[model samples]
Target: MRFDILTVLPGLLESPFAHSILHRAQKKGLTEIHVHNLRDYSSNKHKSVDDYPYGGGSGMVMMIEPFAVCIEKLKAEREYDEIIFMTPDGVTLNQGLANQLSSVKNIMILCGHYKGIDQRVRDLYVTREMSIGDYVLSGGELPAAILVDAIVRLIPGVLSDETSALSDSFQDDMLDAPVYTRPADWKGHKVPDILLSGNTPEIEKWRFEQAMERTKARRPDLLE
Candidate 1:
């Protein structure tokens, strides 16, 4: 998979893709991530990509030209499966969406900054709009990083144990059951005896039941 992110704040994304699973995925050539500076596409001599809103908004709005230029340049090189815009009003991102994107070969994400991008940009270039949640953020860079992490890890060869992604919470419309590591007896608290038992079939059943209970107690909406 290949991801190209457009942002004025590319520096903000340095850490997220440089460490952990994302870094490993890049090292193994399982995925590619490229960050582009929107300013680079600006025609202004000062490289300014934002301007005061036409209707006199309190904050400057990102200009459409830089985004249009960037998107067009990328499109000329190769077809993109999705050109996503990160915004607070877009479709709420979830595990199911992540799973769907995992199969996409090429993606481009535009990160909005300041007050947000010009409306024309969204209408003309974006294939999808995604939001991490109902809240707002200073910029879309962080959410773009988050969305990439959520999808990249689900790619077939990106994870060492492919089954791990399958068992993640929300994959089956239920929360994941609690898990334990070594030290079966932690002080007075003990690991579930079913997990410690050698009976594989029974253990699996116990996990499913626990997952149901957890989902019911927490996000019952998912069950519907």
Candidate 2:
């Protein structure tokens, strides 16, 4: 899979894709992430990509031309499965959505800034819109990083044990059961007796029951 992120602050995203699982994914050829500077597509001599919103607004709106040029150029290279604009008003992103996107071949993420992008840009180019949550952020750079991580990690071979992503919390509409590491006994606590038991079926049943209990106590909404 490949992702092209259009942002005015490309430097802000440097560290996110440079380390951890994302970096490993890139190295292993499981995925490719490229951050494109919106300024590079600006028509103005000063490379301006944002301007005051017409009719009155508190902050500047990202202009349409830069986004259009960048997206069009990228589209020429390869067909994009989705052109997603990151905004607070967009559909709240979830694990299911990440799983869906993991199957796509190409994606273009637009990181909105200031008062957000010109509406025409969204209407003309964006195929989907997503938000990490209901809250707002200073810019979409961080959210884009988060979205990329969520989707990329679900791709086959991205994780050493591919099954690891399948068992992640939310994959089954229930929270993951509690887990314990080595030194089975720690302080006054101990690993679950069932987990230590060699009976696979019994251990699996215990894990499911624990997951259900925790989900009911925490995110009961998932059960519904």
Candidate 3:
């Protein structure tokens, strides 16, 4: 998988892809992440990428020219499966979406800043739009990072135990079952006896029941 991220403040994106699973994914050649500075495509003498909104809104709007140029340039290089705009009003992202995107070959993510990007840019170029949640943020950089992390971790071989991702909380629309580590009997607390019985079938059943009960208590909406 290949991800191209376009942002005015590329610096905000540096640390995310440079560490942990994302960094390992790149090293293993399972994925490639590229960050493009929107200002590089600006035609203005001062290399500005934003301007005052036409209707005189309180916040400035990102200009369309540079964004268009950047998107066009990338499209000319290769076809992208999706051009996604990160915004508050977009479809709320979920695990299923991340799983689907993990199989895609190429994608472009546009990070809107200031107030937001011009609507024309979105209409002309974006194929999809996504939001991490209903709340707003100062910019889309953090959301883009979140999206990339979620998607990349699902790619094959990205995680040491490939099956681990399959059992993540939202993979089956149920939260993960409780887990215990070494020192199973710490202080007065004890690991469930079923887990130590060497009975895989019974343990699996117990986990499923626990997961259902926890989801019912904490997130009943997912069950529906």
Candidate 4:
């Protein structure tokens, strides 16, 4: 999969793709992530991409011209499956959405900034709008990084153990079961007996029960 992200503050997103799973995914040819500076598309002498709102809002609104031009330039190069705008009012992102996007061949994500892009830009260019959560942030650059990470890790071969992504929390609308590693009996805390029994069916059943219980206690919304 290939992801093209547009942001006014591209420097803020540099560290996210430079290490860990995302970095490895790019190296292995499983995924490609490109960050484009929105300012580059500005036509003005000062390269201004935002302006005072026509109705006199407190914060400046991103201009439509740069976004339109940037998106058009990208579309001219190759077709994108989805053009997503990251904003607080968009649909909240979840594991299921990430899973769906992992199969997409190419996508474009626009990072909303200041008061957000002009509404006309969204109506004309964006196919989907996504929010990381219910709360708002200073800008959408962080959310774009989050959305990209969520999608890229689910791509086949991006993870060393492909099944690990499959079993991640929310994949089945259930939280992951508690896990333990070496030094099973650490400071008097022993590993569960069923895990050590090597009984596959029993172990699976236990895990499911644990997940259900954990979900009920912490996030009953998923169970419903």
TM-scores, all candidates, are 0.98, 0.97, 0.98, 0.97
Residue-pair clash count for candidate 4 = 0
lDDT of 2 at 36: 100
Question: lDDT tens string, model 2, 63-156?
Answer: 9999999999999999999999999999999999999999999999999999989999989999999999989999999999999999999999
Tell me the tens digit of each residue's lDDT in model 4 across 69-124.
99999999999999999999999999999989889899999998888789999999
lDDT of 3 by residue, 1-224 (tens): 99999999999999999999999999999999999999999999999999999978698999999999999999999999999999999999999999999999999999999889999999999999999999999999999999999999999999999999999998999999999988889997999999999999999999999999999999999999
Q: State model 2's lDDT.
A: 0.96
Error of 1 at 185 (Å): 1.1
Count of residue pairs whose backbone atoms collide, per candidate = 0, 0, 0, 0
Worst 10 residues of 3 by lDDT: 51-60
- Whole-model lDDT for model 1 versus the true structure? 0.95
Model 1 per-residue lDDT tens digits across residues 1-224: 99999999999999999999999999999999999999999999999999999978599999999999999999999999999999999999999899999999999999999898999999998999999999999999999999999999998888899999999999999999999999999898999999889999999999999999999999999999
3 against 4, candidate with superior lDDT = 3
Cα lDDT over the full model 3: 0.96
Task: lDDT for model 4, please.
Answer: 0.94
By lDDT: ranked, best first:
3, 2, 1, 4
**What TM value does model 4 have?**
0.97
Predicted candidate 1, C-alpha RMSD: 0.8
